[model samples]
Target: MTKRFMTTGLSRRSVLAAALGGIAVPALATRPATAALAVGTAESYVPIAVGAGGGPAGSDRVHVLKVGPDTAHTVLVLVPGMFGAANDFRLLARDLVAQVPGVQVWAFDRREESLADRTGFTTTDPAAYYLDGHYRSLDPATSAFAGHWGLARTLCDLRAVVLAAAGGGRRRVVLGGHSWGATTAMAYAAWDFDGSPGYDQLSALVLMDGGVRGAFAGNGEPVEDSPEQVRERLAAIDGGAVFDLSLSAVGLGSRAESTQIWYQLAGWYAHRDPDGPSVLQPRMPDALRPPVPVTNAALLGVLVDSGFGWPNDISVHSGHLAVSGDVRGWVDTGITPISRVATAYAGGPEPAVWEWYWPARLSVDLDVADAYTDTDLTRSLGLRLFHSGGLDVPLFVFQTSYAQGTIESAAREVVASSRIPYAAYETDNGMNHLDPLFAAPERNTLTTSLPSFITGLR
Candidate 1:
């Protein structure tokens, strides 16, 4: 393996300090929790049951909160990022309803009630618990794999929630997600669930600060690096000592706790940059960018300590300036210029730094093989956007030039390659991978842009 970096005593202390200072970070709101009707208004936080049958192998009763005008024109379903609770979208929902006048918005809790209760229903560790409960044990002989929730299952669950919210009636439905949630939204859209009834309810999809095609292909095909090559790559970056320190400082908590902490920390790091333009710079390399430093610090503090200090390790490069300017031009005017958001979002020292530290600190083996596979998966799914054969509905794809990898590019490529009628746009104000949904005030420039995008769709 690789020589591990040991941030044992002093490093831990510094990290703890930095993490603590980064708490209470806020982002834009994407959903509403409660709303009042006009004079004779009737409002209720109705809990709609979602899932096939009483309970599948590892299924839980999903609950969605719907709030807005009773006679709404369309239903918008918002999905939160990893480690985020359904309530995270409340602000966004409310804002959309206010802007659209008669539109209903629904945000669902993806966590199974049992898992939610055990982990306090937060964003972290939901996947771990899902894996432990659903996919931990498998007779490889009979079962394909063992994990509580995979991309496919999550997509199915989302589809179920949408159908339940519609109450069997056909209506225009807009689907949106932030970060991993955005991935989930795209997966559902690209999924070829032909015989299933859920496919019919989708009207549009919104991908906010989410990576495009080749950036997230984890389990599809082999591209360049062989499995052996990936093993070698992992060997180069494995940091056992760092992981030991991290685990020791944090302690070996429940899978849920550990996962939750990881999510919070990742979020903290993503939003660490304050200057939007600077944050947008990294995307040029990866076609994606990171969020503001304040946001990243707050998220990290919540995960690491209750009082972490924000780090000042921001990098200044010409790549950022070029990408930031491109993104700004795209959003201010509905124009598709030759810009690179996915590259900027994905480009950055942080992800590379994480690659170096992650193997040692988290025991993750990210190799070229994994990267290639992820890219392949992204490309495969991207191809689905072309043929309206599966989902015959109006498709709205929102891309930001501040992202990295093949996310924005692949999305653009798919749109261009598909010859399908679609509405695609890129954000200009330099949003990072998670900024579209996690920006503060829920009413800032970032959040404001979403309503207009959705309204234009109507």
Candidate 2:
């Protein structure tokens, strides 16, 4: 079995040769290059050097899915949700090109350095960042970089990506995001970079299943986690050593089996024991196994076996949760199901264990002292955007009747206050947070309206 180890210090040739030579390799080897899809689109991953924000600064990759020719077209820059990979938008990006005709979609892959599995010190250091079931802080002050990963750096990185993608000059750019990505999008929209409006670079904003403020207390209304609550959710991710953050938060069903499947697909864990046959062997069908030992980069077969007793035919084995059903109850509910998947499939990806340590550090770094002094009306999109003077850009918010409360009221206020035309589309199609991006094009409710809404932009 091929062992995926997260180590540094060797020459690039040594590492690559070891990986090719079937020796111990870093987690980077597990990341498979995305194959170009058949949807008449070209996919290119561009790396942008991001200056330090909250931690050791490095380059972040942006995945561009360009449809038609490479000439100028409306660009929709999408940021993935927390810990989100750009590949999550693969299907949606291709579909948008077909539906909208000229618009190209670029999805950002945020900081992945922590995936090194070592303390954030010199790359050569071998101390595991995660020790004793808790992720240790690796911030410069704490461990390596000046700041850890903070929302400030996140916003800055996104801005840099926008400028770079625009080829320097301003163009019609619609900044969009999903879930936490939507939160970042809203934060980006509100930030006044260089003492000017942050939304200046954005022509419009498209938020899906996130950026809702009504759910928070200091965020204008009292939801569950009040501003006084001190966002422990992200912190919990930092302190907690187990990497079982709910994928259900992003609309995946909350089934332990499915979560295992998702993590396995990410190469977060090993499917095989180092000595014996794969621990996942008995659970998987013979047809699904690759000819060689199942490498982390192997195509993860969607769990389609009904014999496995999984409700949905989707590749993962989430219990009864439908991929498109109401999954909000599971978001932040904190009730993680016991993983029913076998032990081998349940191992943690070495890099993920280390990466979780810094996400909280980044959050803490972005948390400014005076931020609370500025209300959402003037400084941010708190639970909603009010009629602010500078928010003249077009905005489109898509929501389901069940999940529309987060931004509808605020979106209306912004539209009524400004001359900018906006649209809030709602449906009762039982879409969860993930449906808009991952659902099949025809099965997805929000995607159908995208063509008209985008083309309608003046």
Candidate 3:
């Protein structure tokens, strides 16, 4: 393995060339030579300042990648799932733009928990950091557990970014998300913050593989981890627990597959931050240290163990890693944990895995637990989509074959409750959670189904 060094402000052309195994990509006449780009594509980052509402004041800089020209009348803002970051959607966004002319696709960088940090985890390894930082950023003082971290504030952040992307409300916006992002999109649709529904801000909602029901129990109860479980997980973050790396192999297929995934994502992160010193070392193959920074202790724990009772949604099959016979059974039998063999950087002197402590327990977890235990149903706090109000605007749900049952039920519930037109497209494609966004085979489905869905909104 040869190490490739990036100079200060490496251009998109150079980044793409190196990312594609040194493929020579010609520079475009329209854009600058040193722009950060996706592999084989020329998507560049546009910074959107989301002020105030987006946790910890002073305008959090949320970078959005724009694909295609902004001449399109409507903008589709897609948020990524658990570990899914903006760069993950680059290839898909480029493909969509090429396939669906006149419609621009914008993918948002995940919002980080506003904590003072110098690890560059947010920029280098967002998938692992955002999930952890979110839980760590929760505080009882500001009511973030129920308010800021909830869908309402999320909508605020989305609105801020949408407005910035649309160049001050010039274009109509349609929102879409995959997995957890899908659920976020649905929440934005049903949210009623200022006496009016947030749905008014968007033209339509495109949910891929997830939605409101993802956080709810079958009996309408909030799905969450118990306080004891949350505590244990938090402790695990401090003490560090050995996770089954085989679980990662399930979703990513193999170590090489996982490396590619990390490579693409890390490359995007690195490209975006050309001015800062490189967070990754020279050709670090220690799977954990593959140019991508390791997640903090809290984030690693939350990602590996808890959160909505379905931790590591990005990894493992059927969303059940603990009890599932295939994966967990192997873990119980002392099968070599995936973390051990999947990457050589598992445990060593000064290991990068879970190096920092997140201190407080996640507010989002407490909020969900409170909603579950509270006797007064009205007082319960959770995602807006699962709440009472049904969307009045056009709602489109794309339920993949292996979509979570909670999400499926939530979509059905919204359909039953919605007085307005609600449509659900159930496809037989055997896609695990993340396939709809990353899998090239499904590009046809996305290009055809999504564009038509958005156009139908007109």
Residue-pair clashes per prediction, in order, are: 90, 13, 8
lDDT of 1 by residue, 212-300 (tens): 34433321222334546534433443321212123222332333234333332243233343223232123211211223222322222
lDDT of 2 by residue, 163-282 (tens): 766765645788887655665676677666777666777778887655534311112322323343344544454454223333333222332123323343323222232222233333
The regions of model 2 sitting more than 4 angstroms off are 1-38, 54-69, 113-147, 215-228, 231-358, 361-389, 401-404, 416-419
Deviating ranges (above 4 Å) for candidate 1: 1-12, 15-47, 50-59, 111-113, 118-148, 194-199, 215-254, 259-402, 428-430, 440-443
Alpha-carbon local distance difference test for all models: 0.39, 0.44, 0.44
Among the numbered candidates, top TM-score falls to 2
lDDT of 2: 0.44
TM-score of each: 0.52, 0.58, 0.54
**lDDT value for model 3:** 0.44
What lDDT tens digits, residue by residue, belong to model 3 across residues 192-311? 555656676777777776565343332233434455554564455344331112224323223212432333333333334422333333333332221222222111211222111222
Candidate 1 local Cα displacement, residue 261, angstroms: 7.1
Q: List the residue pairs that clash in candidate 3.
A: 11-34, 12-35, 213-406, 244-338, 245-337, 245-338, 245-339, 246-338
